[model samples]
Target chain A: MSAAGAGPGSREGHREPRRAVDGALRADTADTADTADTADTADNPGLAARVTTRRGGFTLDVAVEVAHGEVVAVLGPNGSGKSTLLGTLAGLFDPESATVTLADRVLTDTDAGITVPVHRRRVGLLSQQALLFPHLTAHENVAFGPRCAGQGRRAAGAVADRWLAEMGVAELADRRPSELSGGQAQRVAIARALAVEPDLLLLDEPFAALDVDAAPAVRAVLRRVVRDSVVGGQTVLLVTHDVLDAVVLADRLVVLADGEVVEQGPTAEVLARPRSGFAARIAGLDLVTGTACAGGLHTLDGTLVSGAASEPLDHGDPAVAVFAPRSVAVHRERPAGSPRNVVPVRLAAMEPQGEVVRLRAGASGRGPAWGEGLAADVTPAAVAELGVEPGDELWFAVKATEVAVHPSGR
Target chain B: MTRAAPSSPRTRSSRTGSTGHTLPWPVWVPAVVGFGLIAVPVAGLVLRADWPNFLTLITSDAALDALRLSLQTGLTSTALCLLFGTPLALVLARSDLPGLPVWRSIVLLPLVLPPVVGGLTLLFLLGRTGPVGQLLDAWFGVTVPFSTVAVVIAQTFVAMPFLVVSLEGALRTAGDRYEAVAATLGASPMTALRRVTIPVVLPGLVSGAVLAFARALGEFGATVAFAGSLQGTTRTLPLLIYLDSQDDLDSAVALSLLLVVVAVVVIVATRTRDASGVR
Candidate 1:
C-alpha cells in the first residue's frame, strides 16, 4: 500500500518502516479508488476466517487472515490441515468455534451466533482440478459466473468475453473444458472466479496437480490477475504443498503441522530459518539436534566438534547446529582451509541426489551425541576431485557463519 | 489397425480352437444366451403380429383412446419427473446434508417397489378422501381419482425414482467440483444447477427420463389398482392391453408390438440427441 519500499530487490534487513509505508499507501489507494466507485460501504472489507475440527482423534485448527491484494499461502505437509483450512475458509467445512470474518463482516462467528450460508457468502474457491463445466465452452463457462451474479444474458456474455480476453484465453472461448489443456483450464477457472468478483478467493492446491513446467506459467498468470482485482480489497488464500510456490507468490508463509501453526513469518525469513523439523523439511533442510559448549558443540552421541558458539556458552548447555550440506567442505586428508571448524570424520555412504552427490559422514569416536551422521551435498565434480569414498577418513571444514546454532529445548 | 492376414482353413480352425483358452465360456456364452433370450420375445411379437389387421386393431376407438392417454400421461409424468427429480438427484448426489443416506434410500425406494404398491400408496395419499386429497377437494372441489390426472400421478409415483436414481448416480460420478467452480464465478446454486449441473448430467438425465417414460407407458398393475381401468379416462395402453388380453390375445399382442416399437424409437431418438449434445 505504501510506495516507500517499491525498489526491486532491496535487501535492507528489518525494513519495517518501508514495508509499513508501502502497505499503507497501497491500502489507502485501493480504499480511495474503491470508495469512489462503491460508495465506501462498511461491508466492503469482507471477513476474516478461522476453523477448528476434530475427527477420528485428529484435530484440525487453522486461523487465517486475508488482506486485500495480498496472497496468503497456507503451507504444510500432507495431512497438516492445509485443505481443511481452505475448506473451512470457503464455508464448506463448518467449524465448532466458527469465527471466520472478512473485512468487518462476520462469516462464521460462533460467539456472535452467526453462520452465513455458503452460497450467500460471495466467496470463490478454486480446487486442484479446474472443475470447469465440461458441457460448456470456455466463453460459456466464464459467462456462467456473471450470469449467476444476476447479470442479463448479453451483459454476462460481454463480461465473460472481457475476462476471457484478460486471461489470454479468448481464442479458445468456444472450446469445452475437455478440449483444454491443464494450464488452459486452470486459467479459465481463474477467469471464471474473477468474473464473479468474489469478496474472498480460496485456492486449494490450484497448481499442485500441474506439471512443473506448466505450474510456473499458470502461477504467473494467476498472480497477474489477482493483482488487478476490481474489488476494493480482495482476499486471496492458497493452500499448497509446494514450498517454492509459497516462497514465490505468498506475502506470508503459514506453516501447519498436525493441524497447528508450527511456524509462520514473512516468506523470506521463514524459508531462511524454519522453526520446526517439519518446517525445515518443507524449506529443504535437514534438522539435527545437539548441544553446545565453550570448546565446541557436543552431540548427544558424544561426538565433539569445533563450531561457532550461538550463545555465550556455558560448560554443557543443550543446543542445535544447522548447516547447509553445501557448506560442509570434504577433504581427502587434513587440507589447509580458511574455514575454522574442522572435524575428522569417516565417510559413511554416498548417493546421487538430483544434480549433486550427497555424502553421509560420521565422526569416528562415538557418533554425534543425539543426532545422526552429518550429511554433505556436493557436486559430482567435487566428489570426483576430492576422491571421496565410503570408509575414507576425511577432514570436513564447516565455516562458523554457515553454522546456524540455536538453543535446544529437547 | 491392420487386419489379420487370412489363414488357411485348417489353420483358422486350429486358431479358433486355441482362442478358447484365452476366452472363457461364461463371458461369451452368457452374452449369446442373453441375446437369444431377448430375440425370443421379438420373434414372438413379430411372428404373431397380424400385420393386415394391425391398422384395424390400432384404429379401434378403445385402442386409439388408450394409446392417446398412454402417450399423454407418460409424457406428462416424465416431464414432471425431470422437473422435480433432476434437482432432487443433484441435491442427493451433491449436498453434504445430514441423513443423506436416508434420503438416497428413500428416492430409490420407488425403483424397487412394485408399481402397484406405489400406485396404492399414491391412491391413499392423493385419493379424494385422503389427507392431502381432502384439502384439495375442499379448496378446489376437484376429484383426481379415475381421471387422466390420476393416471399421470400413478405413473409418476412409480417411474420418477428411476430417473432420479440414474441421474443421481451420474451426478455423483461427475462430481460437484464443477458446480463449485461455477459458484466462484458468481453463479448462485440455482444458476449453477441449471447451467452447469443439468448440462453435465444431460446424458444420464435424458436416458433416465426416457426409461421412466417407457416404464410409465407400460405401467399396468399400478394404473389399474390406483387410477382404475376406466375407458377413455385412466385406461392407458398397458391397461387396455391387460383388459384386451382377457377377451382377445391378438389385440393384446398388437398393442404390445406398438409399445415395443415406440420404446425402440424413443431410445434411438435419445441416443441421437445425446450424441449431438456431447459434440
Candidate 2:
C-alpha cells in the first residue's frame, strides 16, 4: 500500500472533503489523530486505525483517530456496536470491509488483502472484567506482559514492581487477583497492559463493572496512565456507555447508534447539539426538529407556537431547537416579565430527577396540535414555592437565546 | 392479640411435628436393599479370605513377582496416559477444529467398550502381523504382545479416558479469559497455556491422574487379554488371583485381601495428595 503524505494540518483542514468519500472514514478521524500523535514521537505517524463491521443484521461503521496523550471515547447505547468496534480494532474480529493502519504499517486492509494475527498486532485490550490470571499474584500479572515480550524472569519482575509502584498498588504485589478488590484488580490490569508498551490501547467498558463510588477513582487512574506521555506516546480508544465519562475524560466523542455514527464531534459540541434522537438520548437532552417561521418555530406537523423567535426564519427552512428542562421557567400566573416567550400550560405531572425536579406540562390548547408536552426542570425550592402539582395551571417562559437553533441537513 | 385457647401451644407443636415427619418405611426398604447389595459382596470377600495365611501368601515368590509387576505396569500406564491425554484434552477443550464432537466420542470409546474388547483392539493394532506392528518390528525389532510394556499399553488404553474427560471438562469450565489477558500482556499461546491455563486447571489434572492411576491398578481383563499371563513377566496381581483360584482357593482369597489392602493404601495416598494440591 502506498503511504499518504497528508500532514495532520491538511487532514484536519480537509476533513469535510475526505468525509465525502465515505462517512465511515470521517469517523476514522479520531483513530487517525491517535496514529498521528504516536507517529510524531516514534518517527512513525500511522499508529492509529478505524474498523467498520456488518454483523448480525447490524452495521457498525466508525472511524476513529487517537493521538499520543489523547483519550478517544466511543460513546453509544446498548448494542450500538461499541464492543464490536473495539474488538475489531484490537484484531479480535475481522471487519468485512475496513482498513487498519498503524504508523507506516498496515495491520489490516481488506482492500489490500492484508490481515495480521491478533497476538502479533501489539494492541493491548482491557475488557470490562480485569481478567487477571487468578492463580498469579498482582506482581506476576503485571510481569506477565513483559515476560511474554521475552524479558528475563528477574528483569520482568523488576519491571513489574516498578509499574505496580507507579500504579500505587505496590503493597498488593503479592496478593492474587481474587484477593484484590475490584479497583485494585483494574489497576493491575492497566499496569499489565502498559507493561507491553503497546502502540495502541483498547478499553471496553473498563469501568462498567466498578461500583459507582469506585468508578471515578478508577477513571482518574486510567486517565493518568493513558494521558501521560511518560508511557510512550500511548493512544487509547475507550468504549463506554456512560456519557458522563465520555464528556469528562474523552478528547472527542463518537456516538454510534444501530451500527452507524449518528453524531461525532468534540464532546461538548455533540452533547450540546445532538442531531438525532439517539444522540439526544445519549446526551441527556430533548431534541426537536422543526421548520422556522416568522411567527415561531413550527413543528413538523404544522403546529405553531408563540415562542421567542430566532433570526428571521425563511418559511420552511429546516432548523433544530434544543433546550434543557431547567431552562424553561414555570409560572403559576402570567406575570409581567422581561422574557418574550410565555405560553399558558397545564401541569401534566411531576417527577423527581436526582437533584432537580421535572415538571411535565402541556401548552394551553394553542400548542402543537398533537402529542406534545413541554418538560420544565426546576429545583425543589421552586417546585415548593410554585406549588407545582398535576392538574395545576401554569405558564412557561423560555428565552429565545436559550433555545439553540442549528440548521438541518448534513 | 386474641385470648389464646388452652390447646393453642399444643396444637401448634403438633402441627410442627407433622410437618417435620421423616420418610416412611416404603422409602427406607429400597434404600436398605441397595445398601445390602453393595455390602454383601464386601462381606463375602472378608468371609472367604484366609486371614491367617494372608501374610504367607503375599510373601510367596510368585505372589511377590505379580505384586511388583502390577505396581510397575500400573504406574507406567498412568504415566503414559498423562503424557498423551493432557495435550489431547487441551486440544479437545480449547480448539475449534472440525468434527471435534466426533473426535470426542472416539476418545471416550474405550469407556463404553468391554475391557476385553478394548484389549483385543489394542492387540490387533500392535500385534506382530498387525499393520503398524510389522513396521515396528522391521524398523526397531520390537515385539509388543505378551510383554510388560504391552500390559502398560493395555491398561493405558482403558484408563486414559478418565483423565482426559475430567481434564477437558475443567478446561472448558475455566474459560479462556485469563489466556486472552495473558496474550494481551505479550505472552504467546504456549506461555499462556503454561502460566495461566495449566495452573488454573491443575486441580482437575491432578484428580484425573489419580483416578486414572486407580483405574489402571485395578485393570484386569484388558491387561490379561492383551499382554497375556506370564509369571514374573506380565502377570499382575489380578492375573495371579485368577490363576490361583483354579486350584488354591485359600491362596487366591489371600491375594484378594492383599489387593484390597493395596487399593486402600492408594486411595488414602490420593486423598492426601489432593488435599495438599488444593492447599
Q: Using TM-score, give the best candidate's number.
A: 2
What is the C-alpha lDDT profile of model 1 across B89-133, one tens digit per residue?
878887789999998888888778887788888788879889988
Task: Give model 1's TM-score versus the native structure.
Answer: 0.71
List ranges where model 2 is wrong by over 4 Å.
A1-47, A229-233, A285-410, B1-49, B137-140, B264-279
Candidate 1: regions farther than 4 A off? A1-48, A120-122, A152-155, A227-235, A285-410, B1-25, B87-91, B94-107, B118-143
Among all windows of 10 consecutive residues in model 1 chain A, the one with the lowest summed lDDT is: A2-11
Residue B219: error of model 1 in Å? 0.7
Whole-model lDDT per candidate:
0.70, 0.72
Each candidate's clash count: 26, 22
Q: Candidate 2 on B1-279: residue-level lDDT in tens?
A: 011111123443553467666898899999999999987887798998888777898899999999999899889988998899999999999899999999999999989999999888878889999888888899999999899988999989999999999899888877777777776666778888888888878878887887888889888988888899999889999899999999998888888888888888887877776645432
Q: State candidate 2's DockQ.
A: 0.20
The best candidate by lDDT is 2
List, residue by residue over A309-405, the lDDT tens digit for candidate 1. 5445456755556667778888876668577666667887786868988776655663232223566788999988988689887776777678755
Residue-level lDDT for B178 in candidate 1: 65
